[model samples]
Target chain A: MKTLALFVVVITGAMLIYAGHDLPAFGDINSPSYQAPMTQYFINNSLEESGVTNIVTALLASYRGYDTLGETAVIFTAGMAVMLLLRRRER
Target chain B: MSRIQESVIIRTIVRIMVPFIELFALYVIMHGASGPGGGFQGGVIFGAAIILYTMIYGIAEGKKKMSDSLDRILASTGLTIYAATGLICIVCGGMFLQYRAVPLLPDPAEVSKYLIDLVEIGIGITVLAVMISLFFDVSPPESEPEEAEE
Candidate 1:
């Protein structure tokens, strides 16, 4: 059973690596995302538009603030779930 | 205390290092708008400082510093701050999370810069509180669960 599991893992890994060959090289200018107009717009105007020097911060907190707000809620929910499940009651 | 935690050297170093680590976390959070670090990373670092303190000083001592009630409040407060910022935008006649809609500053971009910082702070607080509470919950209870300080 262990050998069969290992065989499955190895085949899956090999298939993933084989499929990775089609990916663009890191930071390739010709990559679809890099060539997109939105990407260019963000890169060029994030600082002036958002007044945040860090483009990632500008994107997260200003451009996509709703998404980040949702992420924060998710974190809060996880904490609450852990507390509810694990907290010991006082005797 | 365990032999390792009982060490004078370890205790002294941790005591000295925790404040600095927390200070660095604050720096990471505030500088996030201008630099590489952000709220999530900063909060994790801040939580780690407390966890390290707990490891050496024991859970009871750690709890005294950040009581369970306080942790819950901070967690809620951070989320409130984030949500409030968005609500304020709507009240000011703009879409949610729309920094320009806030009329605090003369320049919309300037308002955005400051609001971004405020939002980052909210994220940092929530992350810090949650991380610390999660660590407290998961770590094994000391030999005596309640106030076992020697």
Candidate 2:
């Protein structure tokens, strides 16, 4: 157990060192996100589309509401599965 | 605490209060649009009313109101309705749940709003009913399965 923990620490330390070389500086405005893929349209359009004030809520409930519904279904499926398993008789 | 006993005062209060609880649940469901509480929250609260009623009354009474088959219907119907509604958009040339291309009544925009709310209500009903059903299925009165095994 002790050796495994030490090995994990050494591997993590090396990985962190490698990761440090590739990350962008904090809050760089000149990145690709500043101009491309039209993030502004969805951000601006969802409020108008949903007629709701909260942006994330509008995006989640209206603009892309179906995705949220799918996620909710996933939750329901999971809960149902847990119930199904728990209700089974032991062999 | 022990089960609540029958008393004139308690009965009178419960008689008046239960209707209000049910009414409030409907209000939450109907007014989900342009409000914070939507179908999910409303459905949960609505189910809570039934669960509470059973607690106050008895399991037999609860079963009379909410049955096992009803639960299966609620759970299955909700998912089916959700998928079918999304499929409408796919048929209309947009992605799933793409309301813009949903192709609706004379004025599509206004109709879409109403339709979406209707869908939300379906989701609420299914979720709420199934949750209550699951609760009852797992914990039916005093006959806990684990106790029998012991």
Candidate 3:
């Protein structure tokens, strides 16, 4: 079982390393991500639209606020689950 | 674990550092609008402070600081704040979570920024409370259940 797990890890690591070659270089301006229309729109107007200097914060808290709300719910649920499962009956 | 816990240096350092850790966490949450932090990161950091305190001081002491009831209240309050903000937007004639339409501020962009900060705060509060609660629940006093059963 340990050998099989090791084999799986080695295969997956090799695949990931091979895939890395196709990725854009760090901070490459001409990268496909940088050229996306949405990326350009965010860069151009996030400050004006959201009044936030940080683009990531603007996107998370305003443009994608609903998604953040859902994520908060997920965290809350997980906490509740842990509390319920592990709580001892206080006498 | 008991030997380390009893070490005066370890206890003294943790006692001194916990307040600073908490302060930094608050800074991260507040400065997240203009910097490299947000609700999740800040919340986790804040939670870590309490967890560290619990580890050093024992669960009973930790519980004294943040009771189970308080933990539950704080967790719900964070979610409530987020949901209430969305509801306010809806009441103000906008879709849910539409910060610009809330009409609290004249400038739409300013409104968005303000709401974003508020939402981040709510996330921070919930995440911090939940993390503390999870730690306490998962690592209860080993003799607690046996004592109760007896």
True contacts kept of each: 0.91, 0.11, 0.94
What is the C-alpha DockQ of each candidate?
0.89, 0.22, 0.78
By TM-score, highest first, what's the ranking? 1, 3, 2
Off by over 4 Å in 3: A88-91, B142-150
Once superposed on the true structure, which residue ranges of model 1 sit more than 4 Å away at CA?
A88-91, B144-150
Clashing pairs in 2: none
Best-performing candidate as measured by DockQ = 1
lDDT of 3 at B96: 93
Query: How many backbone clashes does every candidate have?
Result: 0, 0, 0
Per-candidate TM vs. native? 0.93, 0.69, 0.89
TM-score of 2: 0.69
Give the local distance difference test score of model 2. 0.66
CA lDDT, candidate 1, residue B49: 88
Off by over 4 Å in 2: A1-44, A51-57, A89-91, B5-8, B106-108, B142-150
Per-residue lDDT of model 3, residues B24-137, tens digit only: 999999887999998888998998888888888888888888999999999999999999999999999999998888887789988888888888899999999988887877
Docking class of 1: high
The CAPRI classification for model 2 reads as incorrect
The alpha-carbon deviation from the true structure for residue B1 of candidate 2, after best TM-score superposition, in angstroms, is 10
